[model samples]
Target: MAKAFASAGDMTEKTISFTEVGEGLYAFTAEGDPNSGVIIGDDSVMIVEAQATPRLANKVIDCVRSVTDKPISHVVLTHYHAVRVLGASAFGADQIIMSDKARSMVAERGQEDWDSEFDRFPRLFEGHESIPGLTWPTTTFSGRMSVFLGQRRVDLMQLGRAHTAGDIVIHVPDQNVMFTGDIVEYHSACYCGDGHFGDWGKTLDAIKAYDLDAIAPGRGDALIGREMVNAAIENTRDFVASTYAPAAKVAARGGTLKEAWDAVRAACDPKFADYAIYEHCLPFNVARAFDEAQGIDTPRIWTAERDKAMWAALQG
Candidate 1:
């Protein structure tokens, strides 16, 4: 990801940077906004994640223009989050690739997620009006899919589920680099609202098995060097563990959601106090964790009204 910047609103608080993660592979990361990755192959460019809207997507396009003149032919979405996939039409890519699970998620909950996420984070969806509708992937895969940019092979693998049911990671074996979609967040708040906490840890372990030298995370800067990668992984795991462990403990004690939220806050608030969106994500994270601890496999769909109701019940 070649580095660049664009001033969003003050709520965003920073410009986006297009950092070069590997040769022809870039990560467009905002301060804490949805991160997009770029893979410029031999003949064309493949954007990993589209922004919430075209206005935001164009910023990434502008950065890509600085590096190569190749047209973007594909938009690969790791999951079906509105903040990450809704801007696909703006790229005008001929093909949009996604995992089968991701496609199913869109079919089942895409509309609700679109409405839910828009209400959750308005800044990321700058040009909501420009969106045609729910982003549907033209090319879908089940377990793993390999894309070749001329001779460069980019392996898109559905590692275990963490952030969402359909999470995928783009791996460039030749470059020894991997682009993890929200699987590994650096410094920013972890959105465990719809995550599988137990499976998420396993996914991290699966990612660690790879001898990756560099990684482009879903949020924050591109991580370079082996030690920093280890630290990021550890930090992410710790954050998830702290979140789920406390919530599970409270639930096991027959505590109510309110009590569970408070217990999690007492355990995690001090440790993750400085993380971005701590206040915003805590209530939701606890809710999901509580459900997971109680043997729920799938996350409940989050609607805008449900969001406010949950916040009012838990935080108020």
Candidate 2:
């Protein structure tokens, strides 16, 4: 029998957890569902990643309300993924910030991504109608930008491209807390549909250079201690390398995409088989890795049509 398309069969709801990892830093995770980070500054709050839609985002807003009354003034898009940035309207943040490369990605394929992701994970888009169309960034920066909530300092830096062409990390220097949007996932499978495997490995190294006390990753539970944080980083690095190395080897031998995909699955399934979204992400991840190995640097836009075609060809 053919496998389910993307996460279409994943209909069960997950219990959400709001854990305070640091003094005012919180991670909103849902049993391996897409996670969001909250950084409470002295005078305002900054939301790291918006949920899928306004209705879903409201749940996050409620979580924020329970903790602090300070208004949310900033919403940062780690990259241009629909599941991450489409819910910006709910925050009422004055500044919707993103890396300049991310802004261009929104302009380039945001609509396609919205349609593609919605179909891929229908359960996650429970409030699809509530989305106010593509969420555009009101402000953008190139390398790094810093925002201060009174005396508290939060740094937003683009530390090379990994998950996407414009991935950025939110750093709280004083707290030693880093919100790595999908750049590093803990226990959860890394979705590499739009990933640059080569650059992604180097990006992980850049993140390790930080003196981190805690990390709220894009998915999975927050890492509280240095040991846990380092372990998560190493796990993510191994996942990326393990997946790409075999696929690259196949491509070097002039093998087909299906061959590369099969080889990668056989190698990775044993280790990451139990991880969340591992099966759902494998086909797309393999396709992107195969392309990169074949010398395709930039990722192709994945439209709803292309998503179906790819799934049918690979899983059918």
Candidate 3:
């Protein structure tokens, strides 16, 4: 039998965990589902990455309520992916922050992404109907922006393009904890549907420059020490390299996309087959890698129709 398209068949619910990685830093992780970070400052809280829907985000709110009574004052979007930002309404944050490029991407492809992601991962959008629509950034910065929550300092920086053209990371310098968006996925497949493979590697290198003690990655378990943080970064780098290297090699030889896909699967499956979303991301990852190998610098915007066609072609 043919495999299900994307994650359409994945209905199994995952156990959620709220781990305190630093003094007041928390990682809200749902098995391998998209993860969100919480930074509790002196007077308020800042959330990194909203859940897929307002109803879904309520659960995260409950988690926050269980720990503190301080209102959530800010929502920081790491990128423009629908699964990560559509739940901003539930936060009731005073400011929804994002990079300027991220805001632009939302204006350009937010609707298409909403439709495409909803079809791809039904389980993540459990309360899809409650989504108030595209989440917009109330505040946008071109490079780096710093927020001082009393004495705590949280810096939002757009290092370079990676998972998306406008990927950003939240750095807590005092606590040495970094909330890296999908730019770094620990023990999870990096979805490259709208990624720049070459630039992503350089971005990873830039992330290493920080002296980090812990990391709240986009997925998987939270990294709690410098050793684990470095390991997660290395693992992410390896996964990206393993996925793209084979496909790029094939494309460099003027091979067909199927050939490139097959090569990548053969190269990556042994190691990453058990990772979350590995199957869901393979087709898109290989497609992007093939394009990059052929000297395509920009990632193509993915629509619902294109998603189905790409999945069908790869599955065939």
Candidate 4:
């Protein structure tokens, strides 16, 4: 391999910050690592996304302990990604909720995604052995589901597809705050390996229509205010558009995947080189964009073996 996959060399632990984005709503962000949202309801608590492993989940639990002693009664997974769902078992929440499409994705390619992600970024899976098996949602719904943690109403919605086919967002009506899983990221590269590029902007428009007060994005810092939230949403929009345009152009010209890679790098690197996971997500993003431009709707499953093959092909 010309160089190790980006995550292979990123063994340095990140400093975790627990920032309160809204009243009793918090965002547990670790530098550029995946973020988890905490919604402290009237009686119990609702966790937005589970970390990659039980050990990482425990860290989020500790952050929850600092703020409220409310037991976690619900865990809402925004999508079926391993980093977001595998740690669900550790939460022991009575209700493990996911969108119906998300649960189906879990059945379709859950194990493969777990294997692929683990191999790509082992650092995220600190206690891999502790993961009993693939995480399954106890409850699944389509379109929208309103989950109440006592009197507090947390509306779970499926605006459209962006990060993944099953992507969803957790919205709190009282505070007008939404916990957008990987659908929205701040200062971090959007992982589009399983994404729908054509629908990503539509999804962003859905979230933007809300004009919420705060949003705890999937990664990067918590979006604290209107200006910051809008900026992050648009930034993510720019990232996705910037990544696909050049790759699409290459595909239009019947260029090789390597050529698409070069085009994407030339287009995205100058603007997003300093963003978190920019290099790591580049190849996958480019590959998917190239395929989408050629009319491939569904993203192909990424197994551990395929990850290696893709990385090897993009070594240029």
Candidate 5:
């Protein structure tokens, strides 16, 4: 039987878990769905990657309330994906931050992404009606910037592109904990529809250099040890490489997109078949890998129409 289009058929609710990975840092994870990080500063709080909707963001807020009474002062969107940013309004954060490239993406394809994602994943948009509009960052930075929540310092850096062009990682220097948004996933599929497959490994190396003690990854579990952290990083590296290699070979030989799809499935399914969103990300990952192999420097914008067309052509 043919698979459901994207994650449209994935409607089961995920169990939410709020884990303290550091002194006051928490990871709000829900099974294999998108995860968010909570950094508790001396005075206020900073949220990393808002959920897909206001109702979902409220869940994170509830978790925060259980731990501390501090006001949430900031919301950092690691990238411009609709699932991560559209929930920013619910945070009531005074500062909404993103990388410069991320801001541009919001202007360029934010609406298209919103439309596409909404149609593709209905469960994530549980409270879609509550979303005000497209989420725009109040502050934008280049390669790196630092935001201080009282004396505690939170460094946001664009450690090269991976998941998306504007991907950034949040580093709590004192705690030695990093919040890597979709850049490093544990037991979860990296959504590469708008990813940079070539630079993803190099970017992983940058994160590894830090040798972080704990990592609240974008999905799956909150990594809390050096061994677990390293394992997840390498696993993510392998997943990306495994997805791209076979597709690149197919593209190199002038194979059709469907051919590339089959080749990637043969290479990746054995290793990452059990991963969350594996099926949802497979087609897009194969397409991007094939495009990059053919010298497509930039990712093509994905619209709702484009999504259906690509799904039909490949999944049919």
Candidate 6:
């Protein structure tokens, strides 16, 4: 098993690992920590997600340098999460791309999320000082955007809402490879604090509509074959279901947020107990589910004070 509790200070100097998922595609994973994907074409390269800081992104750049010297023309953000977007400046890509909704989220709450995430997982931030501030996309798209680097076609599609309102998937048709953002995680925990449970399920269904041979998820190891890809998606779907079903059931029966939280904890703890960051994610996931169960659409702001208060009240 991967070590679960690396000291925060240890994060500052940590390097990332590169796993080749396809011919020229790579998944940059750090144990069970958040991951970034890289897709290299005939002429240029497209980075799927930026890491948390410039210092960390340099590690991924080094891996890409080792294999190819193609310029990183585009940095595609899968969503507006702090860890995924803040490190974009380090790439110096000609264009930073994201969905319109994701850009708006950044405008609204990027700083708050930056602060919250750093507080929550200092280990992942590693070289937080290297960040140049909130990373904003230079190019924004609405539904879908398709690009061709020589003959390789890359399709950036907003399948539906999952991990966040603006989640997207990068599909390489010929390679049959897809880079799912936080919409799909493997082995590691899913942070549902800004997720849409019902919409998230629909997004998974849309993902299954693709002809994928492999998948590089937002966390954990990259799925190598069709079977493994499907299993990862199924596991993520089940994880989402298990998280909300109990909370919804209790809410329907007039349970308090505290009661619903307890129910969700009991329901998911057994199944997802061993996943990385489960302890860190459970409280937030339960809180989000509890609110969604009560018909709340948008997730409430998660400031540092709110995080502490919720943890104190929900945790035993």
lDDT against the true structure, each candidate = 0.87, 0.92, 0.91, 0.93, 0.94, 0.85
Writing each residue's lDDT as its tens digit, candidate 1 over 173-267 gives 88989999899988877888889999999999999999689899988888988888888988999999999998899889888999889888888
* Residue 34 Cα positional deviation in candidate 2, in Å, after optimal superposition: 1.1
Q: Estimate each model's TM-score.
A: 0.95, 0.98, 0.98, 0.99, 0.98, 0.94
> Order the candidates by lDDT, highest first — what do you get?
5, 4, 2, 3, 1, 6
Return whichever of 4 and 6 wins on TM-score: 4
- Write the residue-wise lDDT of candidate 4 on 162-228 in tens digits: 9999999999989999999999999999999999999999999999999989999999999988999
lDDT of 3 by residue, 213-259 (tens): 89999999999888998988998999999988999889988998889
Can you tell me which runs of candidate 5 are displaced by over 4 Å?
A: 1-3
Q: Per-residue lDDT for 192-275 in model 5, tens only?
A: 989999999999999999999999999999999999999999999999999889999999899989999999999888999999
Local accuracy of candidate 2 as per-residue lDDT tens digits, 50-111 = 98988879989999999999999999989999999988999999999999999999999999
What's the distance in Å from true for residue 253, model 4?
1.2
| Candidate 2 TM-score, C-alpha based | 0.98
CA RMSD, predictions in order: 5.0, 1.1, 1.2, 0.8, 1.1, 3.3
Best by lDDT: 5
What's the alpha carbon RMSD for model 1?
A: 5.0
lDDT of 1: 0.87
Which residue pairs collide, candidate 6?
A: none
Model 5 TM-score relative to the real fold: 0.98
> What value does the lDDT take at residue 252 in candidate 4?
94
Candidate 1, pairs of clashing residues: 1-19, 1-20, 1-25, 1-26, 1-27, 2-18, 3-18, 4-18
